[model samples]
Target: MSRVKFELPADDLTRATAFYREVFGWETQRLPFEYVLVDTDGEPVDPADADGGISPRTRFVQGPVLIIEVPDVDEVAGKVAAAGGELLNAKERVGEYGFSQYVKDSEGTVLCLWQSIADGTAAV
Candidate 1:
């Protein structure tokens, strides 16, 4: 089955991080490019267990996104387009992590596709 990863939009990283940290006791890690990673607990998410990561809102990401992990981003993207969905952004490499892309399903809901690297350290 395809894995589902949830993403919440954050307009203010500092404020959002603090809120989650205080309210939920979640730990936050600031990645390069001003993106903040939120862990529900202090422990790092096991690659085999994680559903997704939290980050700041981007131009292509206006609201919450559900990232679905796949084996091949390009193939899935083509399938999305062929199924009457539209690609919101081209596939992008997240450093050594993996490749990802955004798409709007037939219902106009924005979703993300994540393809992990060989090391399995990719972010969704």
Candidate 2:
């Protein structure tokens, strides 16, 4: 099964959150950042599932972005442009869990590539 991380862009998170809860029956948890995680499943937000987040729409990121797990972000980051895609940012650490990068696909849809560290707790 492929692991996916998704992000939803919202102008007002509180209102958007209500919609997610009432319409989709999903719960949300707010992180330290302005980001809110949407638990599509009633269970804890498992990494194996399509864990998603919602945040205020940004200037560059106005639409939803989907993330796919990769073995090596740097390796994949190198091939984006040749594939007619654009790397929006360089790979960066997510605390001690993993690294992520945002890239725009050939048709301009922004996506993320994630590479997790097996020994997750060690800081890079």
Give the number of the best model, judged by lDDT. Answer: 1
Candidate 1 local lDDT, 24-81, one digit each (tens)? 8776666666555556756765544454566778887888899898988998999999
lDDT of 2 by residue, 59-112 (tens): 656888887888888777788878889999877886545787889889988888
Per-candidate TM-scores read: 0.83, 0.78
Clashing residue pairs found in predicted model 1: none
lDDT for model 2, please.
Answer: 0.77
Winning model by TM-score: 1
- Model 2 — which ten-residue stretch has the worst lDDT? 42-51
